[model samples]
Target: MYSFLQVLWFVLIAVLWTGYLTLEGFGLGSGMLLRRVARTDKERGAISKAIGPHWDGNEVWLLTAGGATFAAFPEWYATMFSGMYLALALILIALIVRICAIEWRKMVNSTKWRNVWDWAHTVSSWLVPLLFGVAFANLVQGMAIEVVDPSNPMTGVGPENVDLSVHVHNLTGGFFSLLTPFTLLGGVMLTAIFLSHGSLFLAMKLTDEMRERATKMATNTSIVSTGLTAIWALWAQFAFGGSQPLAWIPLAIAAILLIVSTAMTLTGRVRSAFFASFLGIAAAVAFIFTVMAPNVMKSSIHPAYSLTLWDASSSYATLSIMTVVAIILVPIVLAYTVWAYYVFRARISVEDVTPSGLLPYKIRAGENFLTAN
Candidate 1:
């Protein structure tokens, strides 16, 4: 039962992660595509329409993941939240900027105001996932947290023990640090993969010239993203010593599908490409997660401070209660979320931004979005 629950919790975590990646992946991706699409007002409006109505709601998956982590893995929540506060703060700042771009868009009409929001949204959207990619790369690489009693305050132990009074052993990346060029480069690759994934989404949700433009963009984005992912996966395994020789097989499959999906999208298989890109990204993330399994954070400071699945899991009773609640509530949440998406699945158009639309009458439409296209 304990193992079963652990697996369930992991699955839930994966679902939550996938949800955020798919939803916010495109928000960031769509925003990243803005520079390319911004040649004209119609193109810009189409991008806006592509991402509108759903960006903020998409973020709730992150919130839900955090809440689940607290409930199911309190030890992890405490240790990482406390230890990684600095990185988390910057991540939070990016989140705030991303949210503000959506919220503040309605407050102005001038080109300057809209441009400011555009830049904010674009940059924040790009950085958010890059941060995750970096963090995930570091996580899979492992850490240096000590396995000693947590109650004992002073605990940064290394084999060649250097005891700095501070609990956090390192702030900046080290030469031997897991945040190596390969890892950071993987983050960059992830950013591109998500951008391509998002372009497919835009292809599905938009129409007329914009849809055609997105479909064209999706083809190129797929080519580039797949190429980069291929290069990164090879580098990660062979050169960087991340070889799970079999691991590359699934990623290879995902890469093939990415190419095929692009072909499909360009050939008027919009729905196929949309769904295929979803599969492609899911497969890719799964590949990464599989490679990174059993570690959420690694100690750059020293090997002893490393946090792993065994040390970081919550006590049995706590996990039990959380499991019970999740088993009961998660299905309901999934049901409702699916229903809501289906109900709102229609592609948002320029018309929806006008008065009398579902979101326009709301109290908090994005301020930049209020400006005419």
Candidate 2:
């Protein structure tokens, strides 16, 4: 049986991931929709401003989740990272480029400069969530893991130096091994959900023509998102849920909420739709972690090689110290996040957005670039 600290840490890690997905989903979605939904430069600026105040803050949850996982499950972290090194590196690169694009978008007055940054932002936004979806799906579906006996000198660890009883579970699959039909479906499902969530957010936070466009987009995407979510959730639960029958509870809730979100979007209830999508995302993330508990990483090679929460956890003393630190810091983070959202709760419009860059420029039909006040 696992200790209370081990189980508690697992739940806490899940909460962190839920927070990240719930908050950042719309931000990434907005980035993806930047060019598609907004025709004019001013319209694009409004979309960026809508998410600007919270996007960077929202990323903190992801950082915290990674830190917690490293401290609480060192062995799981090591093995998963070793197997997923290339994928993770790509994700990191995409995130870095997206951040730079968002931050540097208004650094120049030229239209070409902003256009290049917008394209970068849109591509990276799409890549990050799709890659994350694939990663999470692999967690549920299991990986190619094999147990290595140190007693065998051929296994790399010298028999004379290492204990014979110590065996390590290592992931033997390469990057190509991660791609499969089910995992690809998972990636598309996540991307669609984010698109709907973002459109709903824009519908709530914009006015006039932009709002109408966003609402129409939300209504259409929500339907697609609902259908895909149903297929993916059912597939994940039935195919890879193992002995955890109770995992169906959160999965059911996620499906229900997503349906409600779709209905709300269809009826032009922007605020309700956005809130439902937010909660639905959180519930979906909860289901993923729920189905993955006990076994942090399932081994496809053999049942005995699966890494359980207890087998991968830190020492009791280490957990005790970390728990103390988390208890003091978590609440503070929550309070500030809530406060920031409340402060930036006002709606935006195209007319409300001023010209971007220190010296904004306009191009006439026959003239060269001209500075605009």
Candidate 3:
């Protein structure tokens, strides 16, 4: 029963992460793509409107994933968060900046202020996904963890006590310690994937000239992301000594979906392209977690210090209660989420966002300089 609950919580946690990557991945992508693909205020507004209704809601997945980890695997959460606090803190800051940028971008009609907000949105968008990529890579690659018994201070070794007794080495080296060649590869691969995903989403949500431009962007980025993903997956499989040999199955599926996604983009199948990108991200995330399962975080210094599923899991009673709660509430969350998306499924266009004279401050393109006069 204990082992089964451990596995179940791990799987649930994995699902949360996968869902975040698939949904919020495009949100981040769309934010960054706002600056890249949108040439005018109307164009930018179109991009913003495309994602605005759903971006905040999409972020809930990340929050839920973090919360689930804290509840289901307290030890793992403690060590991982303490060890990588700097990186995680930066990610938190980026998320805050992103939210601000999205909300404040349209409050004023000044191009200068809007530009400032757009850049903020774009930078945060890129950084958040890149950091997640690097963080997950480091999680899979391993960290400097040292477990010891506070009770047995002199020996610094123990038979076992599950209470929060582990040491996470964060202060000594800081964020740079998390970077490695493999982890760098993971960061870049994830960035590319998010960029591609965002472009595909724009292709799906923007009409006319914006749609064509977004489709082109998706086609170009997907080609590069597909290659990076392949290399990252192969590197992970090789680095781990092929213990989970079957990871190749999903990895292959991911590659195939990515290729199909790009093909659909070329053929002007916008919805199909977006769907493929979403599933491709899910499959890619699945491959990573599947390969790293049973072991939450490995130790860079020594193998014995690794945090396995068994050692890091919460008590059996806690798991049982959380499982019941999740089963009851997850479907309700999904139902509302689906309804929200369905309600806002219409495409966005420049005409849809033209500022009306209803507001006290008039909106005009390039109005910052004129307003000052």
Top candidate (TM-score):
2
Report the alpha-carbon TM-score of model 2 versus the true structure: 0.92
TM-score of each: 0.80, 0.92, 0.90
> Per-residue lDDT tens digits of candidate 2, residues 54-73?
98899999999999999999
Residues 168-275, candidate 1: write the lDDT tens digits.
333233324435676687778879888887778877776666667777888778777878877876665564236355667767777777777777866878789777
If both were scored by TM-score, which would come out higher, candidate 1 or candidate 2? 2
User: Best candidate per lDDT, number?
Assistant: 2
Cα-based lDDT for every prediction: 0.68, 0.87, 0.82
TM-score of 3: 0.90
CA shift at 157, candidate 1, in angstroms?
A: 3.4
Q: Which residue pairs show backbone clashes in model 3? A: none
Q: Across residues 220-300, which tens digit of lDDT does each residue of candidate 3 receive?
A: 898898889888888888887277877888888998998898788778787898899899998988788778877888777
- Between the candidate structures 2 and 3, which one is better when assessed by TM-score? 2
- Model 1, total clashes: 22
Clashes of each: 22, 0, 0
